[model samples]
Target: MFDAQYSENVSHPLRVVPLSQLARAGGLGLGAERSYMAPVLFWIAHGQGRLSVGGALRGYTGHNAIFLPANLSHGIEISPRCQGTAVFFAEKSMLPFPPTELHLRMQGVQVQSEMNQLIEELRLESLSDSPDRDLMLFHRAALMLLWLNRQSGKPHVPSVQVSDMLRAIAQPKR
Candidate 1:
């Protein structure tokens, strides 16, 4: 069942998925887990839920941000009232950056506030029919991810020759 109110957009190299405005059902249970070819940054707001990633289970409440590395199997058990935004970035987006070991770590500073603001802005931009909204939201998403990566002490893995090779092998032609 598709809701007319919820709109989804795929902006070239990235996918911006807003999970709000969907009708709330009963508690969501675990099912077949899947992984992504590109890194996925998810922000959960206004929900009490549990997520299982790479065999580890973590609980989240209120507002929380999580990063799932590419090709890592993960599943979410969303509460009936769950609402959030999920942003997917192609490997190209991480290019010219350092590796996750040196760039993707999270800082102790609470960045949820800023992240929430970005999510709201993205939601608005996604819903709007303006031509520039997609471009604006795309840049905002990149900035948010960079901020989070910088704070976490993770090195920005640049997509150099070697990095590109790795990405290529990680994503073979379909």
Candidate 2:
């Protein structure tokens, strides 16, 4: 049911929707309902806006990237001048990496390049209307997820809460 391995080794299961198309038609975000589907990647090539991540509102501008975990309630409020792409990955599409949330500046060379290239490919493929677009999108999306994970630095291990510890000691379970 899960394939964390490279996408090339698994059946294609990804959908890449171009934000430019949606932007041209009408703005997205603000009204976008909070989702609980899968991890989503948002790349801003231009403009700026505010993003709501798990109830935490964050602001972003051009060249910014946001990686949101599936369980988080996420949405965006694109500015009138905002422009970019949003990737909605199906659950388990880019596996192996423990679920994580991030807001990258993309100022680093590697992060910027990988993101731009991936978005460019998405834009092109989105316009091509190819029969194998699903497979192609999957391969790129997986790679992008892996790239973001690598650039996001070391994994974060959550610290146990003191309250939980006290509760555990107060009420021992057999």
- Top-TM-score candidate index: 2
lDDT of 1: 0.59
TM-score of 1: 0.60
RMSD of each: 9.7, 12.4
lDDT of 1 by residue, 1-174 (tens): 111122333223555675453224322244646566666766776676777776777676666677776656766676657777676665445332223312122223466667777777766766677888757766776666666676666645654786888788999698
Task: Write the residue-wise lDDT of candidate 2 on 1-174 in tens digits.
Answer: 112333434443344555566566563476663654566677888888888776777799888878777656666776657777777676755353436787878786766777898778865775567898767766666567667766677443334674577678999688
Which regions in candidate 2 have their CA more than 4 angstroms from the true location? 1-13, 20-33, 92-98, 108-110, 123-135, 155-174
User: Over all chains combined, what TM-score does candidate 2 have?
Assistant: 0.65
Q: What TM-score, over all chains together, does every model reach?
A: 0.60, 0.65
- Which has the greatest lDDT? 2
Model 1 ranges off by over 4 Å? 1-13, 20-29, 91-110, 126-138, 155-174
Positional deviation of 163 in candidate 1, in angstroms? 18
Clashing pairs in 2: none
